[model samples]
Target chain A: MTTPPPHRPVPQPTQRVVVTSPRTRAPRARRPYSGTREINEQSELGAVYMRTLIRAQRRLGLSVCLVTTGVLALLPLLFSLEPALGRFRVFGLGLPWFLLCVATFPMLLLAGWFYVRQAERSEREFAELVERP
Target chain B: MTSGYAVVAVLVVVLGTILVGAYGLRVSRTTSDFYVASRTVSPWWNASAIGGEYLSAASFVGIAGLIFAYGPDMLWFPVGYTAGYLVLLTMVAAPLRRSGAYTLPDFAEARFRSRAVRGVASVLALAIGWLYLLPQLEGAGLTLNTVTGAPDWVGALIVMVVVTVNVMSGGMRSITFVQAFQYWLKLTAITVPIVFLVVVWQVHGAESLTAPEYPAFRQDTEVTFNNDTMIHAERSLAIRGTGEVDGVRVDGGFVLTDGYHRIGQGSEFTFPKDATVPHLSTMAHNTNESWALPESSGADFPLYGAYSLIIATFLGTMGLPHVIVRFYTNPNGTAARRTTLILLGLLSVFYLMPPVYGALGRLYTPELLMTGQTDAVVLVLPARVVDGIGGELLGALVAGGAFAAFLSTSSGLVVSLAGVLSQDVLRLGGVRGFRISAVLAGVVPLAMTFVSTGMPVADMVGLAFAVAASSLCPLLMLGIWSSRTTTVGAIAGMLAGGVPALTAGLVTMFTDTGDAWYEVLLSRPAAWTVPLGFTVMYVVSLLTQRHVPPGVQRTMVKLHAPENLGLDGSGPGSGDERS
Candidate 1:
């Protein structure tokens, strides 16, 4: 036994039908660019993305190599030009011994660390650019 | 020294390697597993393996001996070796890893799409690998002979057997674990002995290593010339010994002249305390002050030689087939860079110990300078500095470590060389083929050691580096970084740089070229060869610009892109096939 619903007056709603076609731009979904596909297909657009990444990495690598190894390559000339540097005491050891044996290791590690960080960052940026919506 | 303890130590290293490798064998069932552990290695694991393999006999024994004989200038060897990883990290490590290469030749083919380029790379890789192996074999013989009085061939034989047994049982997957374990063993073997030696040094009244006076016999010393030695004694001295000098036996007191005297094999000489030490004729820095200085030792064109050594080691590291193959074992490009960075740290720590041993040897083991067996300075220093049982125990630890170095390096080279031989040469693609190739790889180098004239271990290694830097370094540098490289340029560059450098290195190693003005140029060829390789590659590629591979755009993208960017494996731009 259900009770009868309360009676209420209802007003008619205003409505209009607008004509539209399937070819309307508003109905079509925009597709995100897949740089990955272009690169895979070896398209011109894909080549641009690849070039950007390769260029950035090559520049970082070249500069780092120059800064670290380029300077080191000059050391033999320095030692030759200033013979006294071979015997000058540093930390109770000859300068050459201290520099080559003790100092050079840490310096190499630091340079490597810097290069790795830069390379990772560049690769990350590349991934982001290619994958971005 | 103490052959009993040393023998025990050597046995432990050998047996331990075999057991560990057996464990690796269980996981290795496929061809990929045999070649590169299926590329699943983490940074820390691969880093340790790289360190174990990279610090060959050159770093373990050769660098210390060179430092002892040639003085501080020789410290450049350790420095250049460590710096090489830095060069690798900045330039080649990640790109090479992302290229999906199994070996250096695989990389060449992928880049150039030409069989001819791969052929040249494989040949150069084999040449460099064999050249590098010669020193390790030589050093093994030297170490065994120094500690155990074993025939020189005995140690090389032992190393070959142990490594082959291990590889036969497991392949690279087992070798990786064996090598990683060896790195720590080696570090401890060198480090622990040095700590006690330093304490002993301080307790013995802390003699100055850089003193102005020449090294003298601190106590009455009995010196044995294991190899034929030429020595320079500055003053007449009384000596009592049983041995041959100038091929004639002398068993009693004799007045040694002020000039050079040649001592034959099995010769023994006992020099009194405070007697001026007869110096090795080839190495002439007798005064501690001079020995402590750089560029004072008698290598001709010292500046050019040092610079050439620098170029060869720093650039050559990436091109080493064994070292290159190890990078391919990294799971991806990111891990490859991470591995190299960690490797730099591991190598730096180990390198510090060898130089310390060298410096201490100057004060304690000057007799090594008299005998040309300075390569054994690291093995001898621990026992000489510490006394009694403790010294003997330390000596054993070092001996064990030395064997570990030879085994790890040999295994790495054998794995890579076998990979090339079985896959490229024999066209055999299975675990059985790789196993057969492994044995073949070891035999060639072992046989070559019999014929090649032996140089000091570090010097031979330097020649290998020069060859590698001249040839493969150019190909990797150009191919990975530039898409313009053509097949003709690649082949041309490898031969131009490699052939002349190889000829020079062979000439230096096999033929005697004494005191000629041009001898230094031939002996230390990297100063010329590296530039030639890079220049020829660049210029020829530019000239043959239209001959570049049509698929190069895809290859370049594949090489330079991050793995997760979906550029992994054969096809790029495919839906995520991350497996």
Candidate 2:
């Protein structure tokens, strides 16, 4: 058998070290993020930059998710405040009610939809970048 | 209900899961493979595994029982459970996958760079995992006892033995296979019996018997909680079967009656019109009124506490140790994200079936709730709806699924606990330590099942959510994305959040005093404890932000950056961007 593509000197076998080096190169990635201009460059390096941009955009989506969920979680704290809107009065059970009926679930559903959209958008861009090669 | 075939079917399912795991032993050569399946599991497989682990015995039996006992209100459990994934998808799915950590504790150590925080997290993880496992073991014991008339311990022991072997032999790889298989088992178990039962009900021309036809069917039941206190339960309860009321022959006829009991402030009970039943004693709270469902039944409280619990489950999905660890088996974050979406669909399909059981429980067995047989509503459902061999077969199928649910969830929890215990608690640094920790993790809960027997399964699960939400949730949320996280803050927050929950949970669990403080602490602790934990972490983190280590920037980059950016120095630029 031909010498199996001379095992690229894998400097260290420790999982942590292997994962860290590429992490340091992350900042260099920001250099080519001039929106569509970077995409048009069509160079391999340009593809890499676009990939990085797609990733940053995805990270942006994640941040939005955090903010939304953070706010949503805090929704209950708002209701605990006295004199909210609406009440839960089914079968003579007079309970003070608010957004949970019309708002909480619907808001959650909306948030989920927005998140799926962002994730899908990022996935499509990444796929385009991958196809460039 | 006894069938040799039923016993064989259960054996086949259990043996099958263990055998699958045993078969995976060869692939688990490395420590990484043992813990996370070497980061190569596909989205479908991972989702299946998640679904398998997710459909626990509680979902199988307890929820239907809860619905049977509590009317339509119990439907919230399945809804909340399925919805929790949406929260996870938006907030945590990809970031957690990219964290490149093995367990939740690993995420804390990486994020806060604190061995102390890691230590505390490990302790909390172990505690929660152990706490969660006790119910699973108890459920197993209850299940086997119900199915075969076997001793309760035998069920716990059988599951314990199979799970230990499965976990030790293959780690996540074997578990992935076993769990996926279990999802189908759980689904089939739930669906087949339901369909068969519906067919049987149809044959009996159940349509002739409307809600108005039952003898004790009342237009309204005025539930007066005290000698003078009164609340009207406006909805009618259709009492099934034939009975003589006021010495009159009545087979499927109607009436309205008053059933009530006095309960102190912040107290909850189930009052029975007929005495000797448990849940009929309505849990009366002397009126902050928030403690009891508002005069609106459950229409109060924005979303019901049941829904709040669901929201926590959905958003809290990412915080779960067992659920998150499954993502590590994927090759990258994209796969992990996709796996989460698939999990949503799987969870949705599976959830559709619980309500049917719950609805049927309402029609066939109304007394289950009153007698604490609410837990058995799903278990005995087949016999109630259908007769003979078909019922026995369906029961066997459900038994197998319930067992599968127990094994998958228990093993996943055990694995997560084992990882944390070895890495942080015992500080057992290698592969050998992991295996030992795995076995030790399961043993504690197995032991606990023998000591504790009366705790309600649903309530115990709620306590687990509260503990997890209070402790790990705040820590995980702040640790990632927040540049201000510090070791001292994480440690302090965990203690503040975790200790009160642990104490309240223990008090609520071990004793039946039904004290007001217990209700405040156990039922609504999240409102106070969660804020306390966050406040401590936030304040401490802000104070310590100035002293952040030079490596903090680098770690953040690793966390936030893309996958393919080779960490090599080949990128045509500069220096190590150190502080």
Model 2 per-residue lDDT tens digits across residues B1-579:
355655776798888887788789976765656766756667898889889987787777777665454433445566567666775675566667677776888787767676777778878877778777877887887777667757678988988888877787788778888888888888888888888877877887753221322212112222211112222223333333343333444444344243442222222232334222213344322112232222212323433454346444544456667876776676666666677778877776777677567556655554443334457667767865777777777777787788888888898888888877776767675567777888898888888876663665765776676677778887877766565677777788889987887777776777664545336446535556777888898898788777454455445544544444322122233212210
What is the per-residue lDDT of model 1 for residues B450-537, given as tens digits with 9 covering 90 to 100? 8777678999999999999999999999999888888888888999899988999999998899889999889899999999999998
Q: Which stretches of candidate 2 lie over 4 Å from their true place?
A: A1-113, A120-133, B1-3, B206-311, B515-520, B567-579
> Model 1, stretches more than 4 Å misplaced?
A1-32, B568-579
Q: Each prediction's interface RMSD? A: 18.9, 10.3
Report the Cα lDDT for residue B53, model 1. Answer: 88
Q: What is the TM-score of each candidate against the true structure?
A: 0.94, 0.75
Candidate whose lDDT is highest: 1
lDDT of 2 at B509: 70
In candidate 1, position B250 carries an lDDT of 96
